[model samples]
Target: MASYRGAPYIAEQLQSILKELGANDEVVIVDDASPDNTIEVIRSITDPRIRLIESPQNRGYVRSFEAAVAASRGEYIFLSDQDDVWIPGRVAAMVVALESARVVASNFEMLGGGPRPWIPRLLPAWDRKPIANLLGVMIGYRAYYGCGMAFRRDMVPVFTPIPSYVHESHDLWLAICGNLSRSITHLEKSTLLRRLHDSNETPAGFRSLGRIIAARVMLARLILEARRRLKR
Candidate 1:
């Protein structure tokens, strides 16, 4: 989990996630030099399975997530957000899907019963359609939230050292890696309850035409980079 000024709701989110984990399971949280008492709230949890890595400076959530994935010792790694609630059976379901695919992406519902986002939910039928999925990702049609995604340990090399130009949408980059490698699974059921608030990192509003065009260019470059890394 990557945290930044998430003190208000992280404790509840942590409780939701920790309950689903087994004795040997671990939760690695990389706080991106949060200004709030997020660290203190996490420390109050007092769980041996929880491992917190504090960043000396604010490096952004992308780097924080990269550090968390690198520090994780598990065979299967699941990405998480600091302020979301993990649904029951999320781990088992995603892990089961990951048994056959190198990466798995799942659906999510609104936490407080707000209206759903403009992006549609992912369907099981679209699981292995790499070309179509890549197109969906490029055009902002796919719902590939990092909090609802997981990948195998072997994908670290392919997904890491995230392109220096990628300042946002790190989750989409991971989805690109999975698709380019033709090793991604799309789960049908929702995995977590996403909390949408003003402080959320995800862009809730529309972008200008210039920003949209730039994002498309970035996605194109990301696709090429993924293919280069996986030699696809």
Candidate 2:
């Protein structure tokens, strides 16, 4: 999990996740030097499974999640946002899916009737089409949110060093690696309650044509990079 100024809601989110985790399961969180009491709230949780890493400086969530992934010791890695609540079966569902696939992406619903998503929810049939999945990601259709995704530990090298130019959409970069390798699985159920608000890093609104084109170019470059890494 990547945490910023999440003091207002992180405690509730952590409570939701902690219940689902076992004694051996772990939650790795990297706090990006939040100015708020985010760090304090995390420490108050008192769970041995919760591992919090404090960043010396604010490096944005991309690098924070990267650092958290690096420090994680689990064979299965789950990405999470600090303020969202995980559903009861999320860990079990995604872990079961990951047994056969390198990566798994799931659907999500709005929390407390938060703003509705602009794109359509993901369907189970979509998992079978790798080409379509790649194109969906390229055009910004597939909802490959980090909060709803999980991957195997072996994919760490493939997903990280997250393309120097990618300041955002690290989850999309992971989706690209999964799809490029044709090893992604789509879960039909909503795994978590996504809490979308103004502070959310992912833009909920549409992008300008220029920004859209730039994102496409970035996705293309990510595909090439992922292909090269997989070849090695």
Best-fitting candidate, measured by lDDT?
Answer: 1
Q: Give per-residue CA lDDT, model 2, range 56-112, as digits (tens).
A: 999989999999999999999999998889999999999999999999999898898
User: Model 1: number of clashes?
Assistant: 0
**Per-residue error at 64 for model 1, in Å?**
0.6
Query: Candidate 2 has which clashing residue pairs, if any?
Result: none
Assess candidate 2 and give its lDDT.
Answer: 0.90
Give each model's clash number.
Answer: 0, 0
* TM-score versus the correct structure, for each prediction: 0.98, 0.96
lDDT of 1 by residue, 1-232 (tens): 9999999999999999998899999999999998889999999999999999999999989999999998999999999998899999999999999999999999998998877787888888887589999999988888699999999999999999899998889999999999888899999899999998899988778899999999999999999999998973
Q: Which candidate achieves the best TM-score against the true structure? A: 1
Cand. 2 TM to true fold: 0.96
| Off by more than 4 A, model 2 | none
